[model samples]
Target: MIKLLIADDSALMRKLLQDIFVAEGDFDIRLARNGAEALDLVRSFDPQVITLDVQMPDMDGLTCLSQIMIEMPRPVVMVSSLTAEGAEETLEAIELGAVDFVAKPSGAVSLEIDRLRPVLVEKVRAASKARIRRTLRLTERVRHQMRSAVTARVRPKPARRRPVSGAGKPKQKPGPSALPGLVLIGSSTGGPAALDAVLPSLPGDFPWPVLVAQHLPASFTGPFARRLNSECQLSVVEVGNPMPLQAGTIYIARGDADVVVAARATGIIAMPAPARASYLWHPSVERMVLSALECIDAERMLGVMLTGMGNDGAAAMKKLSEGGGRTIAEAESTAVVWGMPGELVKNGGAGLVRPVDDIAEAIVELVGAHASH
Candidate 1:
């Protein structure tokens, strides 16, 4: 059984969350009234997965989450409201090491909470599979430091990472003309922070139009793009209404539906994800890759898979590789879940595997040669 903990200030909310998980019948659940209680229970219950409220009286969720990560690294999913403030705090929580988040339903005591049940259950299961890393966690002090740097538009010096074995660095160097015609990426679980890390590394004038598909809720994707645009060199936009593609700007797939790329007389058009294209995750990675491949010859394409929970993009990435595209996957050492990229590696889909920190530099050097032109 998955040992689970539900921490919230509201008694009703706590009970509602617990009942949602209890129906799963595979979790041993524990409840805490606030951050302080959550901390207390952590020592005793030792939950495999934790659901945290973004706001809790006495001790807020963010503070408690940092402490949990620093003291004992386990999977955490934020249970936040659907408001704007809730979205911002939840994104911060993800960057801080919480696996993922689910928004609270419409009202105080509405049965609408049941709508979030699948999301809650899936996030917990994914968290249970996380590597449970506890080393060099971002303390509250570091978070403040990073924020101060962001406000000044000055990039903070990132923490140093030690190299791990088995992850093969790119064997072939990116020559002067090694840049691809297009770049496609897909991720889930730990993707928000991973994208934050990668996008900032490229130059403001990157050549190819980078398209990305991530498993995220519709409410969060727009805010995520806005947040990324503030910190990264490249401009980020969420695909909502149909528009032609452009280089130097990153287009993120809409979380509400699939984003299909099609070749049109006017360059490329972004299409709404059709119901006919059934998939496990919204903005499915495989569907994106397949569509791109059908519409464009991928000989000069590049596919990169970041930290995520499943094999949504593996097969398509493999086909991309076979069809003569450069492909890379985040090494297991840095991936939070490693499911998507790991599947690629196992199937010999990735030509290169590097740590999360190195992916951007690799892209900059590999695609930069062409992107700069």
Candidate 2:
């Protein structure tokens, strides 16, 4: 049985969560009413995975999370609200070494709690297997805190470049039918921090437009894009409407929907479409890659699979490789959960396998070389 800890200030929430997990029959669970109690249980219970509520009284969730990461360094899943403030706090929790988060339905005690049961159980199970690299977590926490200290007052710059037309596109393509090479990225679970490592490393003048399909909630994606924009040299925007895909931009797929590219008379554009029941994960990587393939030739595309819980992008990327596209899978050495990228590697899809820190450089080298030819 997996040893689990549940931390929340609300007696109702604690009891509901306990009941949900208790029904599962696989977890030997303990509950704490506040962060202070949670911290104590961390030492005494030594749980394998923890579900931490961000709004806890007495030592708040973020403070407790920091201490836990510094001292114990185990996988933690944050339980957060769906509001904007909740989004910001959840992002910070990821930076502080929490593996993933589940957004609570609106209201203090929601009727939607029952609806959250499946997702909650699934994320906790995934967290149990996640790798918590203490060195990497500590390094990122320090770096992020220092950066946050300096940027506390300044607002993130708005995305400046407008969509580019086909006429304005570079002349490096093989034919009129082929578009400039695109970098398609897919990630989940530990993706936020993994992306923090890669996207900020690329120069502002990166040659290709990058599209990222990260599994997130709608409220969180906007904040996530803004956060990435603040940190990255490249402009980042969440795809909420049909926007022209331009070079040097990173477009994040809106949460709760899938982002797909289509050929416009003027240029390629990305738009958020209704989530398809066929794909299990929202902002589905499999669907995104398949959609892009319909318009862009395989050789002119690159597929990057990052740390995620499931094999969403593997099959589609395998198809991309079989058609001559370049692919990179994050190495197990650096992945918090190696499920997505590991499937890509196992099935002979990846052209290169790299650690999280090395992925940005590899992308620059490969895409830059292709554009030069």
Candidate 3:
């Protein structure tokens, strides 16, 4: 059975969540009223997963999270209000190693409770099996430290210029019916929402195979892919080793593996990292982009970086831009947390920065233009 601990100051919230999991009949649930209580349970119970609320009288979720990671690391799902401040703190918690989060329900207890059931259950299950990484805020001091460490460890590569062939270039072609060469996407913190906005826009007849690397946990990817497949026009599935790439399909990397496109005669194959090779976080955006750049021609690749935290994709996006791929970043106004895409823009790695809605349209336009050519 999956062992779970629910930490929240609100009795109603705790009871509501407990009921949801109990109904599922697959979980062993524990309860904690505050962060301190939760920490104590964690040491003794050693639960497989934890759902920690943002606000608690004894200790805040962030403090508890730090202690949890330092003492005994496990998957944690932060529970927060839907306010702007809540969102900010929730993102911070993620950076501190929380796997995912669920927004606290609002309005009438009955109405809100029902609305949150599905998301809560899903997040709980995902958190139970997620691989969490060590995270630090991307402050100037932290960046300086990282830069120094990187500089001391490795030599910098020569600067490369962004390719301009596709810029303002009209789509011309042998015919209007050719298939898409490749589809590359990057996503971070708010990637799920961004993807929800974009993936469904592609028609069922889309000719390109889609590749996505979302910064998420292993447990989340499977359910996430399934959810996308249900909503999207195309078939969406979590990628596994030796899976053949096909048009009208979306492949999400497993949460514990790097998603890479491997070259093949018919098309690219989805390559997942071996278990031993898995990073603390899987579906690494950087590794995915670099591998895609090496496997496919730039002109044939469509690279997109969506809302996220951190600069994980910035360096690889530079390669994509230089390789003549069409690279796009999520615009700041629409991002949940602008850290990742912002870094790409600051580094001049993005060819275009567009809002979430426009991203889908832009992709279609680019693909259409490529087909025409």
Give the per-residue lDDT digits (tens) of candidate 3, residues 1-373. 9999999998988888899999999999999999999999999999999999999997978778867876787878888876656755664565456767877766776578888897678667755755443322223222333354467534233221221223322211222333358788888665775786688777665667788988665656776776676666678889866676767678898866687777676556887885334333357887877777776787888888887666777888888888778888888777756767889899898888998767877887888788889
lDDT of 2 by residue, 1-373 (tens): 9999999998889999999999999999999999999999999999999999998878889888888887888999999987999999899889788999998767546588888889999899999989885536565474455455478624434332222122223223122333578999999999998998888777766778899999999999999998997777778999999988877689999999999989899788899999999999989999999999999999999999999988998999999999999999999998989999999999999999999978888998888779888
- Backbone-clash count (model 1): 1
Which is the better candidate, 1 or 2, if ranked by lDDT?
2
lDDT of 3: 0.73
The Cα RMSD in angstroms, rounded to one decimal, for candidate 2 relative to the true structure is 5.2
Candidate 1, 60-177: lDDT as tens digits: 8987887887787788989887677777778878867887887778665557776777777877888887864333245643466446546863545453232222132222222233
The list of candidate 1 runs beyond 4 A from truth reads 20-26, 107-115, 132-137, 140-142, 145-180, 274-277, 368-373
Show how many residue pairs clash in every candidate, following the order shown: 1, 0, 5
Look at candidate 2 and tell me the lDDT of residue 45: 99
- Candidate 3, after superposition: displacement of residue 181 in Å? 1.3
